[model samples]
Target: MADDAVTTGPEHTDEPVRVGLVGAGPWATMTQAPMLTGGPETRLVGVWARRAEAARELAEPYGVPAFTEYGALLDECEAVAFAVPPDVQARMATEAARAGKAVLLDKPIGLTLAEAAGLAEAIDSAGVVSQLMLSNRYRPRIREFLARAARFDTLGAQARQITRAFVAGPFAFGWRLEYGVLHDVAPHSLDLLDAAVGKIDRVHATGDTRRWVALTLEHTNGAVSQLALTGEVPEGGYTELAMFGPAGELRLDFRDLAGDEADSAAGWATVRREFAAAVRSGRPHALDVHRGLHLQRLIDQALAGLR
Candidate 1:
């Protein structure tokens, strides 16, 4: 067996997996809770947050029990959906895995590579179904975009994620503001480029995370991807990913989506469905904890380049 091996194999069952939400922040309240309840393959069993009131408020609408204790929430579910800050996610997710519950995680899984590595070790030891909530990856449109891109002999790519998230909004504060865009926005673009192009072998970066940062990634397939990211834009920000090759350009623009809420709900629904499938089959997903760790490593490399 390889050193990075996760699960033994698929368990193959048909029952719905009981899932619990771990966080009362905007992400859990707005996206996680609603989607988990609406999905047929998984059941939202309970909610846990550091603050009891927050958990109660988020869980009440779904008719699920709210607990202040993490362990109590874990006991009610076979899977955990996390929407907390990276540091908090790293700690709680590790415990969730140790308790033998699968985890649905957010990107840049941890603030630091060490924290991510520790979580990955726990997942490997527990052999639980683990999947990262790389929201775009779960989107049907984005999946189709990737499928089409796969058909081309991709040579190089460009991606940009610009936002005023840090200037104002619910996400303006907290870990996002404290840690900056490297941990906040870079993960999504990095994951997309890695998926659309090929495995990233090296990264050269410049600028600061708080403002604008640029990265030139060298993929193992010899395709290069350039990224420009920032959360301090003046007005409404834009996002686009374009790949260039002899065949022409393949592009994805975030503005083309119907609406943020509708698009996000669609993505979340797919996430719950896939997570449940992985748990039932006992098969590790392509975007599992290990993929999160891989992205973490790439971010670490980018940080190093900045230094």
Candidate 2:
């Protein structure tokens, strides 16, 4: 296809939007990295991993510079995809923001709200584009559910169900469980809930690192949703969201794509693409820095047991 009649979205530019990827993990290697192949708007300019060898392995196939330092990658690229673990998120995000680089951070942006907020503030204060990865929003089914649920009066007296995450087999053997279910899974569900119902008002949660969390949330719109987080049950821990109001019930089965290669990036799904477009227009990203900070604040409260 011609670059002018670009298939991805609007024309990013004739030249690629050079990107530096921080965290050359499996997700980056498979999904996010491959986005470069089909789009004329962007290019994978570099890859950074904690280990230089792993960085080289992931970045080599894409023919980009490989490094063990994120600063090096940032110095040479216009933006970055931050796929690093939570502990290091604030530091890296702050650095990129300080550099005025467009940043795409992975889901559950940070370990705590304070860190996420601080980084978010820096990103915003610097006037840079940034978005957290909540690609589930791009799924067609979820979009449909949001529309149907928007007319709450149309659906009535439906059961609201929330199942805990089930992790077994090799899928169970990872850092996801180590980080616990909420941080790993809530990013997708919480955002969906906020969109479907209104913003969450009060939350009551009960659980621990070893077992499960039963959460009840009151939405600002007088809608309530219960989140049962059972980590790694036999059938596996998947999320099912059902909304019933006056007319019909809207149900969405949200599969956990945390480390899954196929669904990790979820396309030029939502914010990043918006951010990219913003870069072209010389304006702010559609996702904006405030949204990310707000989500981080929510993440923090949950972790802090504020609910």
lDDT per residue as tens, model 2, 150-177: 6664221222223334345333534566
Native-to-model Cα distance after best TM-score fit, residue 96 in candidate 1, in Å: 0.9
RMSD of 1: 3.5
lDDT of 1 by residue, 182-231 (tens): 89998888888887888888999999988999999999889998999999
Locate the minimum summed-lDDT window of 10 residues in model 2.
1-10
Model 1 steric clash pairs: none
After best superposition, candidate 1 residue 267: deviation in angstroms? 2.2
Candidate 1's C-alpha runs over 4 A off are 1-14, 258-264
Model 2, global lDDT:
0.64
